[model samples]
Each structure stands twice: as structure tokens, then as C-alpha cells.
Target: MDQNSAKEGKGLSIIAYITIIGVLIAFFMNQEKKNSFTFFHIRQSLGLWLMYFIFGYVISGFDSWMLTYSFWIFFAVLFLYGLLGAISGKANSIPILGDFFQKLFKSLGN
Candidate 1:
């Protein structure tokens, strides 16, 4: 995408990483323009949030602080990574599951 497109989508893109609600907000807001950059981040954030909830449920069963802390840190780093990319107007995916997310949500911005 062009720089202008990136610039236009930057706000909603960053918002997409804020929370699951942000993802929904960005998604509906971007519906008219169908901004690819915003949609890209939306997919990433959506997947991350879903993973967080799913894993959080399982992690809650564990009593070890180490396990809990690790889970928190892992998701935090991933969220931050995606957030920074959106802030910088880049669409670099989060590591590991990024490609999977793109493929999984391929129909999102279509």
C-alpha cells in the first residue's frame, strides 16, 4: 500500500491493538474504506486476543507463578510488537502465528 493509505489507516490500525473492543471498533469503522492496513492489524489483534483468552483459561488452572507470568509476558510482547508496527505504519505481522493469522483472516478486508 502507498504511504497515503498507511497514513490514513494509522489511527484505526493502532486502535486495533488496544483491546478486543478496539478490534471491533476498527473493523466497523474501516468497513466503508476497507483500509487494508487497518484490517491487517485487526486480524492480528483479533487472533492475539482470542489466543490470550483461550490460553488464559488453561493457564488459570496452573498454580505456578512462573507459568502465569510467562503467559502474560508472551502475550504482552506479541501485542507490543504488533502495536509498534501499526504505530510505525508498517504491516509486519507478529512472529510465529502472524502468517497463520493472515491466511486465516484472508477474507477480512476483501
Candidate 2:
């Protein structure tokens, strides 16, 4: 990547790790700039955030006592996967729901 591309990618990358507000800002900023690397990270980060919310909802509904322990483990694994993907520049999906989020947000890239 060129200097401009690298700069743009860096901005996108840092923004992705922030909370939802940062993600939205990054999404719009990248949209205006039209950076490929930025878009890739945005998609991944958005998917991560979406997955977090979905898991929160489902976990809240469960009544099992063991589920509390299992939920933290599962969330930790997913968090690690997301953080690794963002840091390593790999487009690998987060275990189960990653692919679904990609498909769901496909239109956003267009």
C-alpha cells in the first residue's frame, strides 16, 4: 500500500477497536474516503459488535446455572478471535456468526 493507503488503513484500524460510536465514525469516514483496507476492517468490526449484542440477548434469556460460566468462556474466545483478526490483517471470520454478519452487511460495502 502507498502512504495514503497506509494512513487511511491505520485510521480505520484504530477506529475499529473503539466502541460503537467510533465504529460509526470510522464507517462514515471510510465511506467518504473509499479505502479498501478501511472497509475490510469496518466490516469485521461491525460484525464483531453485532455478534456481541446477539450473544448478550441470547445469554440473558438462558436460565441454566452452568450457562453463566460457559457464556464467559465463549465470549472470551470470540473476543480473542476478533482482536486477532483486526491486529493480524487477516479476514478470518469469528467462529460461527462471522460469516452471517458478512453476508448481512454485504450491501453496506456497495
List all candidate RMSDs to the true structure.
0.6, 3.0
Task: Give the Cα lDDT of each candidate.
Answer: 0.94, 0.70
lDDT of 1 by residue, 1-110 (tens): 87888999999999999989999999999999998889999999999999999999999999999999999999999999999999999989899999999999899999
Best by TM-score: 1
lDDT for position 32 in model 2: 71
lDDT of 2 by residue, 1-110 (tens): 35466454765665775776777888888777777666666776788777677877888898876887787788778767766665665656767877776787777656
TM-score of each: 0.97, 0.72
Q: Of the candidates shown, which would achieve the greatest lDDT relative to the real structure?
A: 1
Model 1 has a clash total of 0
Candidate 2 residue 2 Cα shift, in angstroms, is 10
Clashes of each: 0, 0
- Cα deviation at 110, candidate 2, in Å, is 2.0
